[model samples]
Target: MASNVVVDQDSCISCGLCVNNLPNVFRFDDSGKAECFDPSGATEEMIQSDAIDICPVACIHWQ
Candidate 1:
């Protein structure tokens, strides 16, 4: 199954956890907020789940 991940920039604290956890799927924008650069890059569900779980501000979510 394909996953739809989204980061709420307003709620994101720029912790970089998601990027560190899944660089292929998440990245930091010019403003330093987390953004989904390539949702399709997340091939494994576990990695996606880990990203969501590791988000301190709970800004990452599935759309």
Candidate 2:
């Protein structure tokens, strides 16, 4: 499946929750916001549980 994960930098608090939990799929950009570097890096289930669900700011989502 194609990668559909995305992050709202404007809403992100840069808490590192997503990156810490799913490093392969999420990471901090140069501006210090959480961004999806590789949506296909992890399984959809893992991304949903680890990044989307665990995000304190709820900035991550499907695109």
Candidate 3:
């Protein structure tokens, strides 16, 4: 099953970890918060471990 990742803007701390590592899937929005611009940009596995797992603010989640 393919999973879509989402970033909780309210919980985001703008750490840049997700954006810096998984730029294809995540990016900094106009508000400078991390957002999932393209859920299909990266593999679900990579998104889970690299973005969700490493999220300092626990803002990234599987949708």
Candidate 4:
């Protein structure tokens, strides 16, 4: 199954943990908030789970 990793902009604290952990999947905007480069485009399971695990607010989810 293809899983999408999503980050809630409102819940994000700009900790940058997700970006730092999964650069291929996550990025930061001008406001310093992390955003997904391509949700549901993960080619590896480990990267998807890494983003979910490092999200400080646990806002990142896959479905």
Estimate the TM-score of every prediction: 0.86, 0.92, 0.92, 0.72
Task: State in Å the error of residue 14, model 2.
Answer: 0.7
Ranking by lDDT: 2, 3, 1, 4
Evaluate model 4: give its lDDT.
Answer: 0.74
Instruction: Report, for every candidate in turn, its global Cα lDDT versus the true structure.
Output: 0.84, 0.89, 0.88, 0.74
Candidate 1 local lDDT, 32-62, one digit each (tens): 9989988887665755576887788888888
On residues 1-63, what C-alpha lDDT tens digit does candidate 2 reach at each position?
A: 585988989999988888998889888989999889899988999999998998888888898
Error of 3 at 58 (Å): 0.8
On a 0 to 100 scale, what is the lDDT of residue 61 in model 1?
Answer: 84
Error of 1 at 62 (Å): 0.5
Q: What would the TM-score be for candidate 3 when compared with the true structure?
A: 0.92
Global CA lDDT of candidate 2, please? Answer: 0.89
> Model 4, which residues run further than 4 Å from truth?
40-44
Candidate 1 has its poorest 10 consecutive residues by lDDT at: 41-50
